[model samples]
Target chain A: MHFHVEVRNLCKDYPGKRALIDVSFGVERGEIFALIGPNGAGKTTLLRILDLLDEPSSGTVLFRGAEVDYSIKDRKDLRRGIGMVFQRTVLFNMSTFDNVAYGLKVRGMSEREIREGVKAALELVRLQGFEGRNALALSGGEAQRVALAQALAIEPELLLLDEPTANLDPRNASIIEEVLSRVNREGKTTIIMSTHNVFQAENLAHRIALLNEGKIERIGAFQDIFERPHRFLSEFARLENVFSGFSKATPEGTSIIDVGNGLHIEAAFERSGSVIVHIPPEDIILSTRPIVSSARNTLEGLVVQISDLGSIVKLKVRSNRDFTAQITKRSFNDMKIGLNSKVFLAFKASSVKMI
Target chain B: MESPFIEEVLSITLLSLRVSGLAVLIGALAGVPIGTILGFKRFRGKRTLMRLMDVALRSFVNTLMGLPPVVVGLVVYLLLSSSGPLGPLRLLYTPTAMILTQLIMVTPIIIGVTMSAVGGVEESIREKALSLGASNWQATWMVLREARMGLLTAIIVAFGAAISEVGGIMMAGGNIRWFTRTLTTAIVTEVELGNFALAISLGIILLTMAFAINLLLTIMQLRGVRG
Candidate 1:
């Protein structure tokens, strides 16, 4: 797909900090593009410039082959077509209905059109009976949804969400993600969201761009960036996608063993006795007892702690070796596991892949 | 000893009301816009303008607050005399002279209070208005609407100052009975004539007028708080 945005050599300077430096990228039309970076990585600054809230110090931002100029005489008309949801929920202190209808009023729409548009947009966000309620009375999640509803009411050509799920709970986060997907599919509005949550970007974004030091370090499809990340970028990215280490060496020949821990299990793959062991956390399993099972590896351990995470439960088990296991809540309930429960873990030999 | 001086005091009090009320009306119209502009707009000389206003108003108010009524009368005698530059206006010994001096005396107070009120509007509110695509002028009016209660307080304060003052009116109005003799001037003249009963009655009326102005101001401030 051809790009809807063509940013060339964008630069911005503020006092002692260079907010953006020769940044260049093009976002394909209709793609859910996520700009991911750490704090102070200029993500907000760049988004503000793109939204025309702030003027860039230099460079060109071509939206559909035209440069954006916030200082132009016709800038208000330009801003009317672009929708922005700030990180903080900027709902009016008025009724929920007024918050959604404000954009239409500013755009000079008729009263009938405003009423219909606000109703339709509110229904789209599933906030149908909330028009009469005060926006300040809403919960954080509801407030954010109202902000989304306000933006969607404009029927914008492009949507800019600044850390939309930054402070939401997991359930609310999922709801926002679902709402974004629905809008993108139904409206075909081009979206550019900035976030620090890599997992959210991985899951929702069609393309992810890694921003570092006010520059674009890598840009590609979600899995492509995750699987074959740049050497410099992967070092930091791998911190969140942790992997266990394993290796082995024996007399017959050299061989690498994928042990479930960072210990060298004696195996037939490596020559002369020196090696290491590696394990990925997802491969581990937990049980309440020793079972006569066909799996080669079965570790006996006491459950150190049980943590409940809505859909998944994490069991920190300390066997002769310490390891972690993730299982479903139903499985946890079936085993009736509690604090400090003795358990056996099983995984196939093939589950342990040599690195 | 308490003769029926109520009717005499009422007329004098009404005279004071007409002159001071007119002065306050003029002061409010001139002062509010100046204060609003100073409060919201940034210019190269804004701090200097604010400081100048501060020094000039404070000095004038303090000087007027202490000046003896007879001394002001003598000064007006000189200003409206044949040699004074304003003598051509023939405003000497007239109610217009009293109103003009009182207008000048109360304008700074109104302006100063209004400046502080406009300054108190939250910056976040202004930024939100700008982001909403309101022109700067529209945003300014919105901020003024938010600060209207405080500005109203300033106007009331100026009115109170005009009504309670005796020095400027006595000097310029010449305490002309039935024409320019306001409440404070009448009380002073009654006291000079050894009619303690009538003088005390006029004093009571002056006190009541001041109390009423203050009461209205208090009520307005309370409403502002509730809002």
Candidate 2:
């Protein structure tokens, strides 16, 4: 009943900063485990520690019930069982075929065996027939795929990814996600990936670890964690308009939470006492003036900041508290809103999520 | 074309290539691995003793890379002098002595340049290789492969220094006609002896040979890039 890999009280210290703090976790065999967090959360450090590339400042890392021996001279067999894809795609200055064949070749596989392995790996990443192309000459997506193919060519038992899809285009990102799912299901490889993308974790990982400020804040499935409102998670998960407030259940089975600054937020939940909530930026409607509506909350504010994102515009409105409202650029132009314009932010009670 | 001056020029040109080519080849054999090791040494987690050793070794190599030709000539002359340690071999005033002098001059150039080349690609390629199940030696080799063009440039640079040098070969080789004399040494003599025509001709031949060698190596480097 040993976990595939388990870290107990792992810590890593740089000269002036502690990268990881007394972190502990375990992943089951063949499980798609994710370490999700914002930047500087020590996800990369944890992966490097698990990969044996970096020793933890202090702790025990058990791989398949065996404590990793970093001092050992010959750990190729152990290392061959684990593969890591770094956040930066660093392919060798060679043909794609040679880049992918590197692992198999180093393992002393026959040329034919290497060819087959490279072909299979390239096919898995949908980069087949990319053998003769220079890896460095490829586009970012193609190069990342080559990096993936290189790791997959070895077919390791465990795969560690450090933000594999952090900056990829959606099309390439989905392709990598699909490949990871297939590799986990078909190859039976235990996959531990670090990402800040919540939807990706929900879509692929069996469980997620919310890492923050050099420590693992929480670890659970999305459903398991949905009950608890974590401000840290809400912040790093990039959700905006989060407010902590005291709630009282209304007679209508809903609740009204009185946040600070005399702003009371109505939520579609029965939570009492203190709770955290995030209103979707898109859910808030912005108007030139205060207007009456069926929406539960409407705060009058001035547009403090405007971020034009081509199709959509995000305006930070300051009333009693700051609220970010997302609106289509067309809507923004139609309203002729400018800085210091008095605006009304409106959203329904159901739009304020508990976590 | 029927003049015996052509033969003289040919002999000096051939002698220059033989001495410099052999020196560069032997220097690469001895220098590349050392440079690779020096270039890829990591500073983290190493003991103070090891760190000191790395610093000492690097300083030694850096000093050697800038050793002047005349200084190298004097050192090799002392080493191979009659009263010196290697005096028993009687290598003075021979092509072998010239080769040895050039070898000493170029080995550090090769080592220093190669160290830089390997350093450029070391971190990323080494990490990538090890993550791909490469052993320490295998990872080192992968980094070296990635730095191959740099290594080639090192050889070309080393060869240029060796073939163009007149001081070291002149001192160590004594510039003996038809035996130890190279294009560079012969040109020096031709210019000093007031044979401007002969000196200019030898200079052209020397420049041509160097251009051809560099062209060949550069083509190889470009092919590597294309790959």
DockQ of candidate 2 compared with the true complex = 0.68
Tens-digit lDDT track for model 2 on B93-199? 89999899999999998999988898888586788888889888888888898899999999989998998999999999999988988888888898999999988
User: What digit string (tens of lDDT, one per residue) describes model 1 on residues B164-201?
Assistant: 88877887888888778998888789889997887887
Per-candidate DockQ vs. reference: 0.18, 0.68
After superposition, the stretches of candidate 1 with alpha carbons farther than 4 Å from their true spots are A132-138, A228-355, B1-124, B139-227
Tens-digit per-residue lDDT, A211-307, candidate 1: 7778888888976765533444434433222233445444555444543454323333443332233333445667676766766567788888664
- Which residues of candidate 2, in runs, are more than 4 Å off? A240-265, A268-276, A280-355, B1-5, B43-59
How far off is residue B156 in model 1, in Å? 6.1
**What does the TM-score come to for chain B in model 2?**
0.93
Taking the tens digit of each residue's C-alpha lDDT, what string does model 2 give over A90-111?
9998899999999999999998
Give the lowest summed-lDDT range of ten residues in model 2 chain B. B37-46
TM-score of 1: 0.69
Residue A213's C-alpha lDDT in candidate 2?
Answer: 81
